[model samples]
Target: MADKQNVVSVSDRIPALKEQRKKRANRRLIFYLSIFFILIGIVVYFQSPLSHVQQIQVEGNYTGETREIIDQSALVSGESIWSQSLGSAKERVEQIPYIEEATIERSPDNITHYCPRTDRTAYLHNNDQFIPVYGNGKLMEEQSLDTYPSDAPIIFNWQNEELLEAFFVELDKLGSGMINHISEIHPSDDDPTLLRLFMNDGIEVETTIENFASYMAPYPTVARQISEPSDGILHMKMSPYFEAFNPEEYAGRFMKSTLIRVMVG
Candidate 1:
């Protein structure tokens, strides 16, 4: 009986080994099911519309048509967000005149955003047609129009683009009130650096490009002091002064010329 008790039971050992194997099989099956579910989630996410750009939005100032900005970017709706080329789109959008800078971004909500900063500072007068000029001095000649645009002053017969751009930068200091009064501006025949401005209130002005805004700042006050603004010219090149036309002397001189011609004949 003591020897029989010390002997291990083969049937009992078999049941314990089988129980350990079953636990291992169950663990393996659960791990495989978790991995399969994860893969399915990834596949569903990529195929969903939320991962694509369904619309485009723009914020901030853009003077041109919204369609033109979209066309220039070459970004199409319904394209995959992962495939959207943000860098190239920004470069193309910045190529449009008056757009100083452009930036693009996308979101998981199926939207693409584009923003551009632009300024229409002036206009170039070309006969009956006109071209839009930006604050950075970029010209939009392609969008020229037959009708006159009164929003900005007309720059006529300007030959140098570099100088014109610099002049525009100087004009900003005067503020909108002074700038709007400027009807037309032309470079002097003798010196392009000298600018001749035609005021909307019927006064001619002469000033240099270096300090144009500062010199013209006193115009409204000076104009108010003058009794007759239409019959004189304001010189702001160095010292501010008004030179009035002597119509009586001019008429007398004309009479003398006609008298001489009549007597000689």
Candidate 2:
């Protein structure tokens, strides 16, 4: 009787043991599936195309050769986005004189990136034609009227090349419209301290190197004061004012009238 009862108990426990083995197998499968998904995510993150830059686009460039400028600017090309830093790229590009500013961006897929470059256009009237001067003073010799960008204001002579360059930079600061209306700039190498300016609207401006912007700060209001663009010397040396000179009295119409005007006035 004892042997028969022991056999019955062993048979009853067989189904329970099988059920526990199935539960253990299911847990092992779930663990393997979780590890597989994590590996797939890491591969996708590291392998995407946004990893480096594939193309570079340059704009607002005149007189500068694109490939040469890019090389000089030290901008990297045909590399993964993940390898390049935007701040480092910007600093490198700014080293080029023609590029006033640069902006870099990466594509969403990490495969490609682009750089948009801006060039500051400064017009220098030389030999009867208006020539564009880059920030570094390089002359744009390309003679394409149709292909040329919009007209920039002609840089009239100030004191010297240095002073005139400085004046062109400070031009935007002054609200004076004369920069747009000016036709010619004649610098006196004799007294470079005095910048004699000629306007297209038939006027003369005599300003010095020190306070060009300050003198011209009130020029818009002062323009209303003049009936016509006075042909005489508008002296800014002593005070920001104008003096009409007789072309008949002076051999050359423009003169260093600072001493003459102060003595006469």
Candidate 3:
């Protein structure tokens, strides 16, 4: 009777072990199926357009047309954000004239940000049109003079582009008050190295291109010494002098006369 009872206990233990093994197998199958489904979901999300770039936001652009800059970037909607090289994109965008620097960034919401920086130093007047000139003296797009009325000085007939660039570099050093006083700058018909400046206060200045800023620095102080509605020729080519004109007597002879060549500096 003892041996029979022992045999029955051993048989029951075997069935219990089998049941535990089956439960483990079922759990493992469920876990593996769950993992497989999650992997499929990840793959689907990556393959769909959800992971691609949908929009581009531009900022910090002043001279460049925002739409034109974006077009030049070569970054289009539906491009894979993960694969697109942001460094290369920035390089392409900076290639546009007047764009001194550029920065690019991406967001998780399928959007890209492009920021461009530039310094609009001056404008060149050619054929009755105004072209934007950057601090580096590179010419940007041209627009009608009427469309863009500029307080910046207008450069005229500067055939030597190299010299013009250098002149602009020097001009940028002057303060805004002095810069605003200048209305027109033209290369002297007598000497290309010399320039004639027409001031908004009706004073004409003649100086070498190299000495433009220094010679014109004291113009405001000198101008105040004269009476109101002053009209004169401030010659700075050789020595600082002012030739005042009697509005009635020298009305037409202003440019030809050296009558009141009084030394000011």
lDDT of 1 by residue, 1-265 (tens): 7666556566568889999999999999999999999988878877987677778876665454787788888888877777878898889988887677876877774444455555566788887788987766677898887888888888888888777877988776677778888888988766888887888888777688888878888788766665664444566745676655544443311111211110100
Worst 10 residues of 1 by lDDT: 256-265
Candidate 2 per-residue lDDT, tens place, 28-147, comes to 999999999999886786686544456665555554456755565454655655666767766776665555676665564332213343333446655556666554444555532333
Per-model lDDT: 0.73, 0.57, 0.73
Instruction: Please identify model 3 stretches exceeding 4 Å from their true place.
Output: 1-42, 110-116, 142-148, 175-177, 214-218, 235-241, 245-257
- TM-score winner: 1
The 10 consecutive residues of candidate 2 with the worst lDDT sum are 256-265
Evaluate candidate 1 by giving its C-alpha RMSD to the native, one decimal.
9.0
Distance from true position, residue 202, model 1, in Å?
Answer: 1.9
* TM-scores, all models, native as reference: 0.74, 0.58, 0.69
lDDT-superior candidate, 2 or 3: 3
Candidate 3: lDDT of 172?
63
lDDT tens string, model 3, 2-48? Answer: 99999999998998999999999999999999999999997987898
